[model samples]
Target: MAAENQTQVTEFLLLSFHGQPFLFILFLLIYLATLLENSAILALVSLDPHLHSPMYFFLSHLSCLDLCYSSVTVPKILANSLRPQATISYSGCLAQMFFLMWCAGTECALLALMAYDRYAAICQPLRYAHLMRRGLCVAAAASCWLWGMLDSALHTLLASRLSFCGAARLQHIFCDVPPLLRAACSDTRPSRLALHAASLFVGLSPFLTVLASYLRILLAVLRMPTATSRRKAFSTCAAHLVVVALYFVTANLNYNRSSSGAWPVVDTLVSALYCVLTPMLNPLIYSLRNQEVRGALRKVVGAQGTLRLHS
Candidate 1:
């Protein structure tokens, strides 16, 4: 009987601020800024010899992730916001969700890895090079990507199996597991359980790892003999800490909510912060706070100006 009632939804009506030209413009600007900011970071890290270290290597990957991450959903949202009725084909929605989860999962682990990198640099300064060797960094980064892919595959597969029962309206701006589970007419216990488990391992565990790394870093910094040394160590970590707090706070709010309740406005706001705003903010945060990045940016801009003069 349940199988008989299950309907094939060819497309989903995404919750969007449809017909609002103002919102369309706003999101368009945000997406453009995200692209430009992340691109600059990627270019600087790639071209600048000063940024060729493990820290910048990880940062370059982070910029790439942010680029891919925002690309998955923001463009669609911007297109839909201009339409009378915002819609996404069934397959497109699933694809969006897949990449979204992939980036999110990868970033969680990557941030933790970055935290550990900082911890090693600050606490074990004499052994920093040996600790963050190139091979280890590459392997760790590859593992982060692999973990995200596997986790996303599991979630996407589970979501595909769900029967929507003629309901094709998603109560959020994007296709994500929690919203999809809500829209599913099928028994969602398994999916919900998977989500809960993922929340712990994919989300909370990495956050805890970052927390532990920073704590150890804090203890180490306090033991530094000179105030100048302590200040220098703290400065290195400040930007990353801000980025981590912004990401985890928004992510926890977006995903940790009760699945039963409907709060479209709150859901939209949180999701925007997590997926849209955070990516744009990350490069800006690093550029503004990190001296080496700023210096690299200046060098790149100066080179470009000099080239135009020659031409």
Candidate 2:
């Protein structure tokens, strides 16, 4: 195929795993549950004054990100699963990639900021108030959002320039970075280099920050005089740690595994896990594992009950 005459792809087909009715129903339920759970957390945090700490502030943003992150791709997947041939327009694919990348980068930075918040609260309780003021928290969160959007914009700009002369069938459920690069007929080394650099910035850098925060947290916990204090300190960090581990582990596994050549099932499963299941699990980890979130939830429920009774 001549470089100048190669056919430009207007759309691409997403190949899913068999597209069973049961699978579609299952994914639909999971997606709906993710939306409801994350939305509820956001609402509760917004409405409850007692939950207005830096921690819950980050949690609320985390919920919002997860809700949006899942929304960027899951509904499309659910809709696609029911179709005879799952297809997405060129613009739609680019939009999906952009939004997903933005959400992903934002969440990575947000998680690091959340870790620092925990570290400040636990390791430096006396100065926690000074360290994590409203202005600082808002600035941090805003930086995460802005940086993520910038990263996504750059990625989309580069990716949109690539030519596609071969089959337009994507071997995964969504328009992920790796598969899209693979489908490109043009040389993707520049794009791949840019992507790797972005990953290092948005992904690995934050991961290392989280690790350092946890290390400091551990040293602080070890120095505590009482077991009760140690347990309390550790408890505050446990949920975030679980989330970080799940996210980094799955993400590293998915992306670090050969970008072009791999078993499709393994790739698809890993992609689904970090992309779909992680969002669903995040709110659950926060709400179920944190007492303040539980109390806030109960208060919200109780308020609703009282309003219903009065009505």
lDDT of 1 at 175: 88
Tens digit of per-residue lDDT, candidate 2, span 229-253: 8897777677668778888877777
**Worst window of 10 by summed lDDT in candidate 1:** 1-10
lDDT per residue as tens, model 1, 1-311: 55554446789988889877887888889999999999989988889898999988888888899999999999888888878888998898899999999999999999899888888887789999999999999999999999999999999988888888775789988889888888888888878888788889999999999999999998988898999989987876676687788888878777678843377888888888888988998887655468898998888889999999999
The alpha-carbon lDDT assigned to residue 91 of candidate 2 equals: 88
Q: After superposition, how far is residue 229 of candidate 2 from its true place, in Å?
A: 4.0
Which pairs of residues collide in candidate 1? none
Q: Candidate 2 — which residues are off by over 4 angstroms?
A: 1-7, 259-261
C-alpha lDDT (0 to 100) for residue 54 of candidate 2 = 91
Candidate 1 stretches greater than 4 Å from native: 1-7, 225-238, 259-261
